[model samples]
Target: MATITKRSEDYSKWYQELVIKAGLAEPSEVRGCMIIKPYGFAIWEKIQAYLDRRFKETGHQNAYFPIFIPKSFFSKEAEHVEGFAKEAAVVTHYRLKNSPDGKGVIVDPEAKLEEEYIVRPTSETIIWNTYRNWIQSYRDLPILINQWANVVRWEMRTRLFLRTSEFLWQEGHTAHETADEALAEARQMLEVYREFAENLLAVPVIAGSKSPSERFAGAIETFTIEGLMQDGKALQMGTSHFLGQNFAKAFDVKFLNRDGKQEYVWATSWGVSTRLIGALIMTHSDDNGLVLPPKIAPLQVVIVPIYKKTEQLEQITEYVQPIIKGLRAKGITVKFDNDNNKTPGWKFNEYELKGVPVRIAVGPRDMKGRSVEIARRDTLEKKTYPVDNVAEIVDNLLVQIQNDIFQRALDYRQKHTYYVDSWEEFKQRIEEGGFVLAHWDGTDETEARIKELTKATIRVLPVEEIKEQGKDLLTGKLSERRVVFARAY
Candidate 1:
């Protein structure tokens, strides 16, 4: 197996190596695209399963929108088009035919399209256009729907899950009768993402509203959850946007209100993408390999038998049968590896590199003693437990590991987070890394100037903020409260 680079030596290289070595993902033939390996995709499956159940619990239904959107539909929403114009991938040709020069197949001049279609960078426009046909009255006002799909954004630079040209995500677009209803839906979905990020992914995040300049295109408000990675950089985990009537007005989607007046539907959109996989790795994985939270880990437990001869291996396997059955009864995923080709030591290192939350080793001596040795990936702590209660003990240990992993990350964030009041301190702190909470003049020019000087944009404005009077670090202008500033992934 290839060795992973130490994070201290090169955090970026370490990340790339870990992603590959851990069997997560690899670059594809296409530029700025990646192929998510089975192991990596399994992690994403867990994320989707949990969030999907949560979304349905809140009255959202799964629906799919077209991948190809009409070109004219984009021109309807000015801000939305401006935001994604550069990344948009347009399909101008419909078919390919044999070239006259005999160089392989090429786009046939006769196959040119009437009006180009864009590979969707986002579904707000196309979804709203469809909503116009379905919505005609207050009864159809709130269309609560979510779609699991892949999107393309022609990126110049990309990192596997972090910023790939093509990526998987679930987007929720809803239409409501009133602004308050749409705002509530947006806030509700943000809370859903917050809980999913913190509880299931075991990733600690700060919930806040994006600054006006940082809000999603055509959105009146954008709420986000940002996580602090081990390298002291921030990753945007997810976002929920209150789009108001921007898309509705752009698409000419109107409905009959209770007062018998024609009004545009209120709008909101939110999504969480595969970049979350990157956040999970950067937040918790170590130099050894990935350290997956128990809840999100694909294979939670792996059993490796330690033995000398084939006879002993058979004996260990026979004894482990009941144990495996017991664990499975409790709904825990486990694997028993008794292959003779690989040595016990190799198996130990392999499972550690794969980040199995727990490993149980059995041998002749342990069988005789009615016990087995167990090691947890989170802390690398091992203990000998009686075979009879091993299943119950492991179930408890998994819970403890999950909570402890989250706590460790939470502590790291608290330690690395800095509060600065002066420009010098701001510059110094920003250079060092982590979230820099500092006062800003809250002007577009001031925000732009700070990015030029420090390369740190406002990550989020704390939803629950502490009201304080201060001056902007850069301008000495009056300010109210502090916002999080970070150079993000």
Candidate 2:
């Protein structure tokens, strides 16, 4: 068994140990790469299933796109190229051959292509370029497509399921007949992500637009969902960008309207990466180990048949079999652990480390009383319930656990989120860590200066709140409204 320490003492080490011990992910042979084990992949698969359904429900079609884009495609959009240039992994040579001296294999200069290629950090350039050839009429506009793929950003620092050099994600590219439609599409996806993050992942998020300085590279406006981790650091969970004719103009993706006039299509691109897994882990996991939400836990309920000897194992198994079947019938993922080698205490710690939401202990004592002990991962509370109502009680308890986690996070955010009307208070609270609500002059320079002084940046400007008016924090200059500022992941 893994001897894990409390998170309150050493949060980072606690997280690293929990991830490795839980059999979620581990570092790979290659630098900045991770091998996601079965448990981790199962969580990702659950996220994919939920997100895929939401995408389809909102009229998006799935498609595959090339991983490598001609280096020139990235340069087509000046701002985007500038923003991502430092992080891109460029392909200069395609083949390698043995040297004449036989020392080692060398890059085959002779096999080099005329133009270089880049592993896509994001698919905007390539997808937009393809849209140019695909659209010829207004009727053919609003090309809503998403691709499930791995992207490489050559991150200087890496964390599993967070800021890895390479990560799995879905990028949505949509073209619109008008700017309004594209903006609407971006907002729609933003809401979809907010719902998924809050309801399924049980992580509360602040959904709003990004400041000009923090907006996506070439996007006219960027909408994002920001979640605060238990450690008081903010995580930008997902983003939706409205590309108002910028991409369409750069790629010449024009469509002829019914008036027989050609007009550039408006566009949008949005995505959420494996980073959500990191957010989920930080949101609810405790010092003991991960405390997963019932909706996304691979094994919602793990039943441990605790018995003292081999002779008692048969009786425990007989009791567990019916309970397992009942839980499965009610659509709960259940696992029966009847292994005789490991002690009951050992199994309990193992499953707790793995973050199983509910643990049902059917021991000799409880079996005699016609009841079982149900333990909650989040609260670490144990209660005895009649065996006859095992299925129903477990089902309702799972739902309660999910809601409880979300509400706890929401309450924590409410308590920690501070509204600062003065610059001094903003700087002080930002150092303490947590979301600081402050107004801005809406200038990139001011934003950059604040970030230079303090690492915190505008997490998101509430779409609804920004519509109202407020004053600037620093200049006391009249401002549009407030935005959230925090040190982010």
Candidate 3:
């Protein structure tokens, strides 16, 4: 097996190596795209299942939207167009035919499209346009819909899950009757994402609103959950935007109110993408390989039977049957690897590299002692558990492993986070890494200047709305409160 580079030695290389070595993802023939392998996709499926349940619980419905968006639809929302225009992938020709020169197939000039279509970077424009037709009265005012699909942005510098040219994600677009309702929906979804990131993914994140300069384009407010990576950089886990009728007005999506007055519908759009997979990797994976949170690990428990003979293996299998049943009964996914082509030692290393939360090895000696050797991926600790009670012991161990990794990540964030009161301190401390908690002038020019000098941007602001008397580190101008600033993925 290929060795993973130590994170401390080279963080970027370590991430790329872990994604591939751990059987997560690899670059595809299409430049800037990725082929998510089965193991990696299974982790995503877990994320989808968890989030989908939460979304349904909150009264949202799953729907499908076209991947090809009419190019003209983007022109309706000016800010939206300005934000994503450069990255939009346009389709001009529909048909390809054999070249007269006999060079391979080529685009036929006669097949030029009447109007161009853009591979959707986002679904707001198309969905809003569709809503205009579906919504006509107060009863149809709130349209909460989400779609799970792949989108293209034509990125120049792509990194697997982080910023690929094409990626899979679920985008929620909702239309509401009032601003308050839209705002509440946006905040609600933000909390949903926060809960999933912290509880399901075992990733600790700070929930806050983005500054004007950092807010999603066309959104009056953009709420986000920012996670601190092991490299002291920030990763935006998810975002919920209160669009404030901008899209509705752009698309002429107006509905009659209770008072019988026509008004544009308030809008909110939120999403969590596969980039979250990148956040997961950076948060817990180590030099040995990935250290997946128990909840998200595809194969939470893997059992390898160690024996030199078929008879010994049969005994081990007999002993393993009930154990697997018990674990499955407890709702844990378990894999029994008794392939003869590979040795037990090889299977052990393989499972470790793949980040299985727990592993149990049953051998002749173990069977004689009525015990099974258990190991944890998080701490790499091994202990022998009574065979009869192994399932109960493992059930508890899985929760502990999840909590342990989250606590470890939280500790790392606290250790690396810094507070600065001056420009010199800001520059010096930022270079050292982690979230830089500092005051900003709360102006776009100041924010832009800070980013120009130091690559860090404001990751998030405290939701508690703390207002402290201070001066901006860069301008020495009047300021209130502090925001997290970090160079991000």
Q: Which numbered prediction scores highest in lDDT against the true structure?
A: 1
- Candidate 1 vs candidate 2: the lDDT winner is 1
The order of the candidates by lDDT, greatest first, is 1, 3, 2
TM-score for every candidate vs. truth?
A: 0.99, 0.97, 0.98
Candidate 1's C-alpha lDDT? Answer: 0.93
Off by over 4 Å in 2: 99-104, 466-470
Enumerate clash totals for all models, in the order shown: 0, 0, 0
lDDT tens readout by residue for model 1, 29-127: 989999999999999999999999999999999998899999999999999999999999999998899988998999988989999999999999999
Query: On TM-score, who's better, 1 or 2?
Result: 1
Candidate 3 off by > 4 Å: none
Tens-digit per-residue lDDT, 1-489, candidate 3? 678889889999999998998899999999999999999999999999999999999999999989999999999999999999999899999999999999999999999999999999999999999999999998986888999999999888999899999999999999999999999999999999999998999899999999898889799999999999988889999999999989988999899999999999999999999999999999998888889999999999999999989999999989999999999999999999989899998888888889999999999999999999999999999999899977899999999999999999999999988888988888887887899999988898999999999988998996866589888988899888988899888
**lDDT values, one for every candidate:** 0.93, 0.91, 0.92
Worst 10 residues of 2 by lDDT: 466-475
Colliding pairs, model 3: none
Runs of candidate 1 exceeding 4 Å displacement: none
